[model samples]
Target: MSRELFYNSQSAYEKIHLQNALIFELSKVTIPSIREIMVGQLNFINKELAQKVAAKVGVQVTELEFPNQSLPADSNYQDLQSEEREAHTKLSAALSMDNTIKNTIKGRKIGFIIANGVNALHVQDLKTKLEGEDAVVEIIGPSMAQVTTNDGSMVTPKHSLTSIASVAFDALYIAAGEDSVKELLMANNKPHVLNFINEAYKHCKAIYFGEGSEPLYMNSNISLKKHIDPAIVSWEDETPDNKFIDAIAQHRVWYLELERNTQD
Candidate 1:
């Protein structure tokens, strides 16, 4: 049988196109029942969406049927205190400083290694800045007795290098001045001084050096030239205080992992 009906071809095409567009726009709407059923399986909980949909449709999500899926708990699942707590604790521990010591270096022990003819200005600037941030800054020298600065001012060391190990301080700063660097290099034979620096480097502690302090590092370990990095910061480039402070706050550098791997 053959039958023909006259109709506007343009009208038919437009009607079909409009129907497809409407279907696409409608699918963009998130289905609340489906989301509620996949709460644990997806990145977000749909409790709020479920409530909104239930209100609009005048029905409970529990009325919906899920043939092969597990529905979310009836109770609210929006709170994530447990998950947030774990993440917070882990990050804090890794940084070695909790919220208490984040902005300020409060209670952290910072050692300034100096000797005869040490740069008085460098020592003063670093000590003042660190102490202003509430960190405990102590002067360490070869002797617990008095040492002279480049300006002929007598400064006493709070602790001797031999008495206190590098592990005792959170960070170390070597002052600038040729005389101090020369003396430190001469003392390289003393295993305690070299071991102190080496141990600090191995442990990934921040070490700051002034312009003339390179000799101390170079003489302590000949291989230092190969792996020196920002973990061993220097004022030679006139680096700003904030850069050093931010590095200290990070507690360790990504390069430390590289050094550790090489050692292993």
Candidate 2:
């Protein structure tokens, strides 16, 4: 009877040990699945919050998709990663611009952002110079309605400020005219205009503002005095159009001044 009791106790201990080991192995698999689901739920919640904030600010938010998977199976090629890297490297190398008349405005589309009371003579001269170099020039206005320059010449615009984005143009010119600047500064939804200029500045595009248009820059959200971006050519009697052309030929001017100020 004593021997039988001892054997039964040993059998019970073995069963308990096996049960514990089985539970330990099962937890290893289940815990990671639980963690993965939690992580997925957190990401979804974060994205929903972001979209809500964007909606409040009147901006649209888009989610990213895996680009490689989107490619058609027939068009997909092997070793595309190395080919894409090589293409990008070549593009970066080709983007550098040299200061030369040969580089002058050729094949570039320049936009003259103007309003009513624009300086007709200045616009004419600048347009002539730019077009002479085979550059395309377009007049962009705040509205589709015809605008009369200070000289009483009717100027028609190809696109409105609201319709076209600043990224469409390689360079931007703000014509000289007090009344024009006043209209721009006082217009309802004026930030649209300011935002256009700000976006151009941020993109490092060549920008020119005619003389006596200080109020336009001063009042706008951008503080040009505090931080000047390169390739900004302000024209007056002192600065020649040729100089502006040279600056434009240099393509993008470094945003070092703005970057340094932010760090300080």
User: Which one is best on lDDT?
Assistant: 2
Among residues 3 or more apart in sequence or in different chains, the pairs in candidate 2 whose N, CA or C atoms overlap within 3 Å are: none
lDDT per residue for candidate 1 within 1-264, as digits (tens), equals 101111111133322333334334434558755444433222122334334334443334452232223336673344422232222121122322222244546677878888889999878988898888778898988887798999999999998888889888887887788888777767443566677788777666778877687766775542453565666777755554555666666564544544444553
C-alpha RMSD in Å of predicted model 1 compared with the true structure: 21.4
lDDT tens per residue, model 2, 1-264: 221222123333232332334334434654544433333332233444334333333334444222233356776445342222222121221222221234656888888988889899999999999888888999988888898999999999998888999999888887888888877777563676787788877666777888657776665545644555556677653555776676666555544323533554
Candidate 2's displacement at residue 66, Å, is: 18
Model 1: lDDT equals: 0.61
Stretches off by above 4 angstroms in model 1 are: 1-103, 187-190, 221-228, 262-264
Top-scoring candidate (TM-score): 2
Please list the Cα RMSD from the true structure of every candidate, rounded to 1 decimal place.
21.4, 21.0
Q: Model 2: residues >4 Å from true position, as ranges? A: 1-102, 221-228, 254-262
How does candidate 1 fare on TM-score? 0.57
Give each model's clash number.
Answer: 0, 0
